[model samples]
Target: MTNFDQLHRFIFNQANVRGEIARLDDSLQHIVHSYEYPVQIQQLLSEMAAATCLLAAILKFKGEIGLQIQGQGALKYAVVNATDDHTLRGVARWDEDLPSLPESFAELMEKGVLVITITPEDGERYQGMVALDKPTLAECIEGYFAQSEQLATKVILRTDLSEPERAKAAGVLLQVMPTKASNTDVAQDTGFEHLCKLTETLSSEELFSLPVEDILYRLYHQEEVEMFEPATIQFACTCSRTRSAEALRNVDKAELLQIVEEEGAVKMNCQYCHTEYRFDSIDVEAIHAGRFEDTATKTQ
Candidate 1:
């Protein structure tokens, strides 16, 4: 059986094109089950999470990448983050009391924008945003690549949210990077488009169930392709009491202490994983005193 939660990278040597196939299982489960998300939102989050993983794995970066959508529609906000190692986490908030939510990306996020943020380990952080002009996230991503880097790219995101308990998400990314070699642009562009057609023939079931190598061969049996080692993708929330405490550093100490006195503890909940961090009077004191990290890590 194919191992779940792995991303396979492949290159078409003759075409000078690269592609990725990712299958997500455990990662989807971890995110969807973290909160009580509506079916529509859950599906959107699943697709965004998978796309984020695919995006992160392809980039040559050392830090994190985030894919986010913001608007005032039924789904107010949704975001997913992925690190260099393909670790991912995501969250979504919407109008829960609505009788029904829009299914299409454009309607779900009226006046929304698709944002991509890249934070490198050593360099400056970069963010790019585009209006939610397309009906799907895949199209918007393709547009992003075209607008930002002027690269020819194709993206496909699929999810099965019919049964929340068995939620599944998977995707593929194909891009034609600039070739320094002389007289190869025509051949590369032709090959890249041909490969994209074959890639579009891939069904959701085949992507979810087939082995990585088999999937590639099924699509590009006639092409000269090289497959690399697969990277594991997982759901990992980068939240903790210490990090949460750090968030409260700039807030009013008097107000925080007042909450501690009235509500018994200052509370902060991670929207991604729903992990709660509570601070009583002593914890509040330590946090403001700049001595909370040591104690918080120990207790956690």
Candidate 2:
């Protein structure tokens, strides 16, 4: 069987249209492992994961791309992040039991806005946000591209629940870039429209099942397409005890001691990975004494 957790890129040989597809099997499964999420949230995270992976693969940065949504309704927040290398992690929060399956995006995330953040390795981070007026996550991202970058971009995503504790997500992105190459009045417009029409034939099952070439051929048999090297995508978390310690160090010594005295230990839990880190009395005292080294990369 073909590996599903990979990102593939393709280009229309005779047109300015280019595209990317990402399939997430392993990464989605991993993100849902620790907690038992409802069907609707599970599917929601799967879609967010797929979209984040595809966006991460295309951005020209070395750090990470984060897709975050905040709501004033049932679901308080949802977030997914993927690095340039396709390492992804995500989580969500809600107050009570949500519907097993939401009928639409509005049902799950009411009055929500999508926040996109790009954090480069060695520069200031940039963030862009858009209101969620679209019906699907793909459409929301497409809206971002149109408003933020002014590119003609379309995103199509699919998620399937074929087995217990397993999920498959796939998506394709098509974008047209302005070029200086001359073309007949009708040629370039016709070519771009044709490519988009071909891309519309992609089925959800085919997106999750067939290999890349078969899917490409099924969509665009008349046009010559160039496929690029694939990038492997997987689930990864950046949480660590050192990072937690740094956060703890930001608190006042007196306040920290009071918490330690009352609770006997300072407990820090990573919201992303759900990993817990505890600092007992002695550990807190050490930090107060300024005896700890850098707490950022200790786990590394």
Candidate 3:
């Protein structure tokens, strides 16, 4: 019984460390239901989605974070996006006949690169790339943090795909806060290590089942923890007919009309939500003429 689709943030008052815990149920189900992915693929995407939410919670800005895996093996690519408001959507592309899911990350995503992109609503976008040479996605993410931000980070992600109707994903992240001149290195290191040891004891079953407060109490009851109000996470797709029409406007007019003539309409499907938007010749004409509102009125 997991209370899913929630993100909790907590700070250790005794140490210069902050943590986030996130669990996804309905959001996970919505993503998996969008595609008929294998169990392994679904689990992987679930973990990524959970991780994205956790990372998004840690950000201090107003924007979205995207996590992507590009591989040369059976898993071609996987992407998860989480907005500052906690909306999530994700998709993965893979070879249909993946003989069997590879047991190790290296084998599953051979020669892959993990790319993290942050798009701020008011600032310049940032991107970081890391080689996926680690045994687990969590370790890869930790490595990225260490390399890009010079911060020691630990991440644990778990996914349960046994129940089709109750697919679950959960993850926890802990990071060392930047040290000040007054802060002692030895003290920070000891605090970080102790927190990591406590977090390492978390089992997937416990993580998938326990409430956020209970989980925190179980792990850090000895420490002074300040729990913040939890945030709701949902499966939200940023797709719209207007966006589809804008995409159509990008095509050459001749090519766009040619497709409409052949197929009777230009059909666009959102990969994230599987919603289809169709535009007949008249709609295409309105889009080109910059009179999309008129087309909408006519259709109505």
Candidate 4:
């Protein structure tokens, strides 16, 4: 069986091409079980998680990448966030019991927009958007790369939701590396085409079952490829009580007091992790007084 929750990166030694493969097993299961999501939504979330990890691994900066899809259809929104450390979290919002749902990406997401955001630790944030016009999420991602990065890119995503307990998601990304001006004739790079064709032969079963090395060997046995050490990915939520407290502190004081008076406490729940943070009258008073340390102590 493949090593679960690991991402591997590789490059063609003879061509300006790079690739990544990310496989999620336990992490996918954890995300699926975190919420009472339908099977189709679970599958979509799994694929987005895998894709986020793959995209995060390719970035040279220390930060996070996010993929979001919003539409007016039954599925209101879906989002996946992946940090440079391979930690990921995601959630989706939709109308319950969506009827007669079509499986095609565009049909399911009526008037949808796919947005890709990259926030680097020490640089300006970047965002790219594309319409959900393709039949598959993978194709839409490819469209984003084509329009934003102007690089030839291909994305393949797969999810196995037959067994809820063992749900798995896996994906591959291939992109042409920036070449020197003198070598800008990408069309003449027959090696890149050959590698892409080889990668296209990958099956979902192979992606979920075979080891990373074995899969790479099977796909590029004839080519000289350099594979990097794999990075482990995990389902992790970054929400914290301190952050929640700060959010509460930023709210209008009178309104917060009103909530405290009505409910006897102010409560906040993290959508990503479903963690609940509660603050009583004393905590709210400390927050209004700017005594954050005291509020933390009281909450503890």
Candidate 5:
């Protein structure tokens, strides 16, 4: 019955295929409003976030998975991260002084590369790269699956960021299931393409407004779909004063003290959540003096 801010998994009983749908409302707003980005920029980040949510559902790991795209064009980069618990956050940067903005994702990049990083809790980190030659983020992701997993995958990402305060994003992931049936009949089956066509007809309006069950019915009313328990998606930033101090620890203490003396405080802002942290001379000295516990960390 969940309408938004949730992800659902469904499988067709008659076909060897599975799909996932993610509806993001409040989660999208939390990220879209973190900075005063234009509608296009907001839309880009929304797609990345939705894609992250969908990918996280299918991938299993103990830690987190991150998707980042960098290009030699107007959009410098955009990245989104999703944890195993369904928490996600993202941010993007682009040229603000353009006379006119490009409407398509590919137009923003001259030579783009999308990187997917997997960091398991107890294992080595892994990274996979895909060329961003596709017209949209969804297609590029589909290409990634095609190249890396060698699976027939179709990804549909839709977003409405015209109203940044009430932005909504949704995505659908459809892929052929691996089974003895697939081992038996790879050429005779056309169910995967048929399901993808039904999924393709899902408009942004229907995705953003309808409940999961209703949307599933609209797409697969004739097919037998088995729904699994859904999971809630949320916006979470792992940025705090401690992490800020740890980030600052890399800088020279004397330089930090000079900045504090000039501005009366050293200020640091978390780009993910727009939270500001200030440190005075005492805080700076204490930080350098090892007053806070140190742990292996990275800036968010």
Candidate 6:
């Protein structure tokens, strides 16, 4: 049996800080399957998928978050979107193949920037951009949390590819509570530094494969951590024929008709779910009517 993908939250009994660790299985699989991506892109997708899921876990609102990595270099664009439900889908855009593997995050995204956008279902959206000069994706994310949210946070991500096509991506986040004061002199109250030190000692394999309790135990055996119920993470897309039809509504009617005349029909495909929605001449007329008749109705 496969271990269920889950996100776990824990807090130090004595410290005023909180932490989260998440393992993504279904979500990772869905992302990699969305396209026939190169091995390097797959690796990047795994890391970004984990990072996005972890970011969603720390939010106190209900919305979707998009984590994007972009540059003018060969790597151009790599992005992942995760929702409050831990459902995720991601894709990458790269043109030519590189001569060699990327040695570090900097090499992959030359002069890149990390763009984070939070879109709440009911409130105004927020966006933050951070320089991607860090050596690793984790470091860039930590930098974002520090500068954008002012939270002393650390993120560690790991992805493994082996036989049987086994792929695992996991991330851990430690953040000082917003209300906590940052001070160095108070040894007893210095939980933030202590937590960071403990988390830094974690290894990639342990983070990705081992159970959450075992990993936390190894990291904080010296201190007490109160663990909470885990939230499962999965690969799910919100795309639907209804939503696709709405997109069709936005396009200029004449433009859509021109394509339909040449191609015989209008086919809309969602990159996130790899699902195609086809609109024939009749369907286009209905779209212009501001209503879509159900496929069932057409068949009838």
Flag the better candidate by TM-score, 2 or 5.
Answer: 2
Q: How do the residues 73-165 of candidate 1 rate in per-residue lDDT, one tens digit apiece?
A: 898889999999989998888988999998777889988998999999999999999888998999999989878766788999999776659
TM-score per candidate: 0.93, 0.89, 0.93, 0.93, 0.88, 0.90
- The models' CA-based lDDT, in order, is 0.84, 0.80, 0.86, 0.83, 0.84, 0.78
Off by over 4 Å in 3: 180-190, 294-300
Candidate 1: C-alpha lDDT? 0.84
Which residue pairs in candidate 5 collide? none
* Collision pairs in model 6: 27-235
Q: What is the lDDT of residue 137 in candidate 2?
A: 83
lDDT of 4 by residue, 106-128 (tens): 76678999999999999999998
Tens digit of per-residue lDDT, candidate 2, span 59-175 = 776899999989877778889999988899999886575444455788778898999999999899999999988888888998898788666777888888767678778888887
On the 0 to 100 scale, the lDDT of residue 184 in model 3 is: 41
lDDT of 2 at 139: 89
Candidate 3 structure quality by residue, lDDT tens digits, 1-300: 455799989998877888999999887887876788877788889889999999997668899999999999989999999999999999999888766787667888889999999999999999999999998999999999888877788899998888876788999999887765323463365488789999999999889878878999999999999998889999998778888888888888788789999999888888888877788888888889988752331121
How far is 255's C-alpha from truth in model 3 (Å)? 1.7
Worst 10 residues of 4 by lDDT: 291-300
Question: In candidate 6, what residue range of length 10 has the lowest lDDT sum?
Answer: 179-188
State model 5's lDDT: 0.84
Model 6: per-residue Cα lDDT over 200-246, one tens digit each: 89998677666778898999999889999888788777777677777
**Residue 33 miss distance in model 5 (angstroms):** 2.0
lDDT value, residue 299 of candidate 4: 26
Q: For candidate 4, give the lDDT of residue 227.
A: 91
